[model samples]
Target: MTVALLETAWLVPLYPLLAALLSLAWSPGLISRTGPRPCGYLNLLMVSAAFVHSVVALTALHTNARAGAEALYRPITFGWTWLDTAGLRIGFDGLITEPALVAMTVITGLHVLVQLYSIAYLEMDWGWPRFFGSLSFFEAGLCALVLTDSLFFSYVILELLTFGTYLIVGTWYNQPLVVKGARDAFLTKRIGDLILLAGVIALLPLTGTWNFHGLQGWAADQINNHNTLPPAITLILLALIAGPMGKCAQIPLHLWLDEAMESPLPSTVLRNSVVVVGGAWVLLRLEPLIELSPLVQTVLVIVGGTSALVGSLIALAQIDVKRALSFLVSSWLGLLFVAVGLGGIDVADHLMLVYPLAMALMLMAVGAIVLTNITQDLTQLGGLWSKRPLMGLAFLTGAAGLMALPPFGGFAALRELLELTAASSSPAVLGGVVLITNALISAGLIRVFGLIWAGRPSVFTTRSPEVLWLMALPTFVLMGLMLHLPQLLVINGVFSLSPLPGWGPQALPLLLSTLVGGGLSAVFYLRPHPLAHLPAALGGLQDWLAHDMQTERFYHRTVVWLVVSLARLSAWSDDRLIDGFSGASGSAAMAGARRLSLTTSGRSQLYALTLVLGVVLMAIWLLATPAAAPELVRPFS
Candidate 1:
């Protein structure tokens, strides 16, 4: 029975793909008679099916483990040959195993909940077919990416996701901002994809396979044999890191995610919750290679730490509702990167598993509020607590789930990371950074909540109402999940909860820091006239944080300038050298043709005289040469 259930794992992604195709039936030309609402319903059903099947597969794996089956601990790969030529072979392989199945279950489950939330969130609109279809397409791509064991296919699936993001973000293409946002998002991720391709190409020749497990085995062999990679391979590993940095919205490539806020809120829910995780997911898979390079590892830690610090700072200054939450996504992913850099995969995995539920709930709660107010500006929203208490509670629950609060996944995952960091040199310093970053993350969430919910109601939110049941149900449902995640983690044996007596050493400092940050934000922003404005001396600093520390401007001066300069140089060279040489050669040929044309005549007498002169010249040349042949032989032959 377990074997049969595991065999059905391939249907996970297929369900969503089929749903996407079915959604096309609602396109304008195909089924004009029917309303588009069913399109969303169909997608919800499909995602539900996918999630259920995933649960079954996960249950089978667990059962097999209980039964002591050999395959329980190993990846059960199902694949077919895809390519074979000239000593090269590749396969489309999916791994139905422990963590992969677990990840799939979570991904599909959130997809189902998000789709349900979107049903009412977008009910007044008429873009259901395109919206729901894109959601399913994204789900299928993400599911396939998690399940695929082959690195080569992982790249392919990620590219599909990039396109899916473009399509989904650009769904409102009638708006200019949406178009630009989609274009920027696509290009940003494409840059990382290209660099990752370079790394894959370089590694394939050396490793002879593109499977993640195969790569792991090869890495282990190298380590066991005391082999070291050359500098070039180390650079390749760095190139590989570039992909995740961009995908995960790390610095220098994070502008796209901010711009992508022009998209619908439902898309933001997934992008913030799970889509960005895709990048870190790939990075986690490549951990074996990443562990081999000290320089690359240090870079990861530096980038992650910097993003966490800066992202939290920027989130604090943002008045735009989605931008605040969006920046936090970067901050959270940054911590995950740090965990991976510190060789804490279990911590990273725990963080990823718990991240999507809480974040999605928060975003959905925000979406619920935005639906009524029709604005994402926190400065223009307040006192919603009286009307939309569930949303307020959901947001608070999400904040608790994300911060180092008790009984939530964030507290557990972060405490583990803190414990791990304690063993490093300057443990005090590294641990301080972790505590400070978490404190700031907590502060940022509180700041947003205070600005939007706790103070006097702004004109924009004065008439705010509870979101429809469809939206509220999903928000509360996910809120429940966030609350119980730590319990789930404990039950699954992925993490063990320390009894209350054992909590002081690890959990106290984090809890205290969170309270400090949360209390400060609440005190400052939760009043009718709260210290809403900065002092004159700090105005410049406030502006910098509000504008993402002018990162885009810096890019314009540096990377953009370099690219523009190279393009201008290429155009100038083409015009001056390539075009000039070709033009001169053509002119010379034309002038010669003109001169040759002048020698021709239209008179028969002139033609006869020319022929007679030619024959005379030949006779004179023959006579001048003493060894000339006979006239007939020379002239006729």
Candidate 2:
């Protein structure tokens, strides 16, 4: 029965898919009498089933592993012909492996939790069908993404996810900010999606297959054989990373995640947790190909390092609590990129596994606070610890799970990453990058906690109460999962049990970094600080970081401006060059035709008489001129 579930794993996505499609009926009032609640409930049920299905499949796979059944544990590939033509065939392929099942479990499980929470969160919302449907759609896309074996199909799934993001973020279409957020996010992500598609299309021709296993083999053969990669192939490999760069919210394409917070918090929970990791998921798969080029790996390190440091810094400056968290999501994913760059896929895997649960837990706790107090601005919130101790504890758990605190999943993951970077080419320089980024991340997390729950009550926090039970339930459940995650890591042998809990060769430095950063932030925000920096001292710097280091402005003056200018130029050229040339040619032709038509008098008799007279005149001229009519003139002489 367990093996059968694995065989039918593809059906998991379809459940939520069908729910999303059926939800359309609600929007059109086909089910108005029952209200939009049914659509939400239906999607919730579908997601829950997918979660259970994934759990069972995962358990079965592990059961097989423990039983020493190699065949059952081996990746089982199943696919149907999607497109088959002359020398062209695309298959809807799926691979059921332990990792894929684990990802499915996380994705669907998060969806179920978010759906349950959304019920009370968006209780009075009229756009329930659209909201719930987009959520279901996201689950379906992510589930299929992890399951699919083909890079081409993964790109397809990512495109679907990009569209789903736009829909979900624009759930409150009535709000102008939401509309702008949706549009920016869609366009920004599309830039990466389009480039990644180019890489995907270009890849099949060079490597001869889109399957992950095939690509892995091909890349390994090329590298082991010591073959030099063509410059174009290297470019293609770099292009492949672009999608993940955008999806993971790294560097220049990073701001989309911040703005996407215009959506409701329930969707924000999933977006921050599972959805942002979507790109990293694809990047991990492409690590083998990326490993082939030193230049590409260097590019990854630079981008990853820059984003890690900068994103954390920006998070520290953000007053909007959601934006702060979103930027940190970018920061954490940057570490994953660095791992992939350094050829530390195992460490990257550990980071990927822990990030979603921790981020989700934090978002849910914050969501509860934001829902109750009615503000996402840090300046407008304070002293919530007394009012909502359960949530405060939950928030602390989430923060601990995220930071390099002892015994949490995050400590194990970072320790592994630190070891990897320390063994790299520039150990001191690169390892320092990892340490500094973690410190900033640690500082940022505690800074958030201090602002919201540690200080004196603000107007917004004075009357704040505990959120509804539905929201509280998921927050605590995730908190429990976060605590159990370290043990699970040991059980699965991703990390062996440390001699002291979460302690190792790298533990001291990582823990020290966490403490120094968090301790300093605690002093500034948590301890009734008259020790804070003066506004004049931090004036320009604070504004710059708070405004995302003025990235949007920089983009406006650069990328956005270039795009808008080119668009205007294209429109002008169409009107002036293309249209003018065609119009001038048409006018010239018409004028020539008009003059020719005027020369014809429209009288057949006059035309005939003129022709005869012209011929007679020609004859007379020939007769009068001796050279013209030599034979006729000889008789006259």
Candidate 3:
């Protein structure tokens, strides 16, 4: 029975996709009488079905493993060939087993929560069909991405997600910022997609397969045979890493996520939680291949570490509430990247597992506040804890889950990451990076919490009421999940013991950092104080970090300028060279035709007179020039 379910796991993604298609029936004119609310419910039903199947499959896999049916625990892969030509083959192969199913369960579960959350969040909006359809499509794409075992197809699904983000982000097409955000998101991700495609094409000939399992085996064999990838192929590996780097919103490619906040909050919830991590999921699969090149590994560490550190700093400077949360997403994922670079796969997986719930809860809490107040500026919100106790509790729970405090999901995962980093040669430095990142994250979250829920009442929060039951229910549900994550981990043996007893020299730095960060934030902003402004001397620097370290401006002067310049050059060449040549030829043809038209009279007498005059002129020229006449006669002879 377990085998049968595993074999049919492909149906999981298809379920949501079918729901997406069904949503079209609710489009404006197709079913105008039924209204758009029903579309949301339809999509919800589809996601719930997928969630149910995912749960069944996960339970079956776990049961088989516990029963010692090790053979049944093996990855059950089956799919038809998708493409075949010239001795190359790509297929839709899937691995239905533990980690993949586990990812699917999280993704589908989040989809269910997000759909319910959106129903209430968007209750007043008239764009339900497009909104819900995009959600279903995103769910399907992410689910397929997790279940598929092929690197080639992973890129394909990622591209789909990129397009889906464009659609979802631009849902309110009337808004200029929304359109711009959507365009930026699409173009930025496209750059990564193209680079990844190049890497995939280059990789297939070398590895001779695209399947993750096959590639892993081949990579292992190459290492065992003492055959290392050459310099050129190592560069290809670097190119491959860029795809995930951009997808995961690492430095340089990280600007898209910030701009994407112009999207609806529900979409932001999923993007922040799972969609952004899709790149990292692919990276985890390609970890073996990336580890082959030390240069690539170092690159990953540098990118991840730098992004983590800088992203946290930038988060502190952000006044826009969503951007604060957005930067933290990059920061945490940055830690995951560092783990992968340090060859800590288990730690990275642990990070991914613990991240979504907490992040979703926080974002949902933020959304609830924003909905009630119609504002996201931290400075404009305060003293809502009394009226909206549930949101405050939800936010605090999320904040705890995210920070390195005791008994929370983040603490264990971060402690384990700290342990992993401690074993490295530069433990002090790498471990400090983790500690500092945690501290800054703690400070950032606390700062927001104080500004929004602590101080005296501001205009925005003066009369704030709790959000609708739809939104609040999901927030509480996910909050419960975040709160229970550590317990669940312990029960499953994922965490061996209580977190406090595991504290040692390795955990000391993380603990101190979180405490210091949290303490500083509480002291400065926890009361009715000025809205936490940077000092006068730090004006320039504060603005820099607040503006995403001016990364967008830097790109404008460099990448954006270069691309725009090249585009202008191309346009100029087409206008001057190609268009000029065509225009000149056209002008000359028209001139000759006009001159010919002057000779063509509508009367036969005019034609005869012109011919007679031409003959008489020729006769006169022949008589005057006998030498020219001889040349003309020679041709005739």
Candidate 4:
């Protein structure tokens, strides 16, 4: 029974994809009387099916694992040849692994909650078909991305997710910001996707296979020989990092998530939680190859550290509620990159495992607030603790789950990261950075909590009522999951109890950092404090970080400006040089044809005279150059 279900794991992605396609019928009002809700219900059922399938398969794998270690790591692959030629072959081969199954369960489960949350959140909205379809579209792509064994196919799936983001983000097409946000999201991720494609294509010629296992074996060979990747291949690995860098919302490419906030809150839940990790998923798969290059590893550390530290700082300064979480996503995933860079695959796996749960719960909790209050601006929200204590607790639970506080999901992940960094090449620099990033993250999450549920009631919260059960239910359920996630992980054997004791050498500092960060934030925004809003002198610095450190403006001046300039040049060339040359040649042909037509009198004498003149010119040219005449007549002779 377990084998049968595991063999059919490939059908999981198709369920949602079929739902997305079915949405087309109602989305375009083919059945106008039923409204779009039927389509939505169908999508919900489909995602639920996916969720169940993944859970059962995962459960079966775990149960069967008692047989031996082989049952745990053995891949159940399902795929077919997509392209085949003498020297090149591309396969649609997908494999089910323990990690892939786990990812599917998280992805589909979140989709279920998000879809349920959206029912009430978008109840009045008529774009349900488009919205729900796109949501399923994201789940389908993410599922396939995890299941696929080919790196080339992973790139394809990531591109599909990018497109789905644009579609979902633009669901409210009437809004200018929505359209702009969709465009920015697509274009920014495209930059990474294109570079990743280059790396994917380039890798095949060198390694001769795109299969993850094959690449792993090849990387192991290089590791065995103690050989560094050649400089050119090193560039390929670096290029490969760009895809995840953009997907995970790392710095520079990070602004897309902020812009994508124009999307609905429910979709924001997925983007903030799992969708962005699709790139990180690929990066984790490519860890073996990345390990073969020390330079690439160092680059990962620099980029990840900068994103981790700067993203947390930026999150602290963000007044827009969703933007605050968006930056934190980058910060957390940055730690994932840091882990992979330092060769802490197990630690990275742990970080990736817990991130989506806490993030989803927090977003679901915030989604309730945003839906009721009709605002997402931090300053405009306050004093919801009394009205929405459950949600407040939900938010707090999520915050704890996200931070490195003891007895939660994030503590283990962060402690493991801290432990990994301690023995790294530069322990102080690496470990201090992770510790500080955790502090800043704790501070940022609490700061948002203080602004929303702790301070005196702002105008937005004065009469804010509780949200519908649909929204509240998912938040509460996820909150419960977040609270119990550590035990769940332990039962599932993600990590043993040894690394998860109440106190350890690394756990203490992580706990202290969380305290210091959360304590200061609570004192400032939760109660009266002189420095809560900052002094006037630091106001400029505050504003700078709030605006994402002028990251967008910088891109507009550089990359955007260059792209616009090149586009204008291409347009001008098409009109001026290309079109102008064609126009000139066309006009000359018309003029010469007109002259020749006028001379084409029906008079036989004139025709004969013209023929004689043509012959005389040919003879004159032949006489002028005898050598030319012989060469010209050679073919005929």
Best by lDDT: 4
State every prediction's TM-score relative to the real structure. Answer: 0.94, 0.94, 0.92, 0.94
RMSD in Å for model 3? 4.7
When summed lDDT is taken over every stretch of 10 residues in candidate 2, the lowest stretch is: 65-74
- The global Cα lDDT (0 to 1) of model 1 is 0.85
Per-model C-alpha lDDT, please? 0.85, 0.88, 0.88, 0.89
Candidate 3: which pairs clash?
none
Of the pair 2 and 3, which is ahead by TM-score? 2
- Per-residue lDDT tens digits of candidate 4, residues 302-343? 989999999999999988999899899999999999999999
Give candidate 2's error at residue 68 in angstroms.
7.4
Question: Which segments of candidate 1 are over 4 A away from where they belong?
Answer: 1-3, 64-71, 500-504, 528-530, 608-637
1-637: candidate 2 lDDT, tens digit per residue: 8878866777889989998998999977888888888888998998899999989877777775542253255567789988999888899788877788889999998888899899999988888999999999999999999989899999999999999999999998989999999999999898888889999999998999999989999999997899877789988988899999999999988988988999999999999999999899999999988988888999999999999999998998888989999999998999999999999998899899989999999999999999989899998888888898888788889889889988888988898889888889988988888889888988898888988999899999999876778887877888899888888887878777757444677888999999998888888989668654447876789888889888889989999899999999999999999999999999999999999888887899989999999999999999998874556445654
> RMSD of each candidate?
4.4, 4.8, 4.7, 3.5
Worst 10 residues of 4 by lDDT: 65-74
Q: After superposition, how far is residue 37 of candidate 2 from its true place, in Å?
A: 0.7
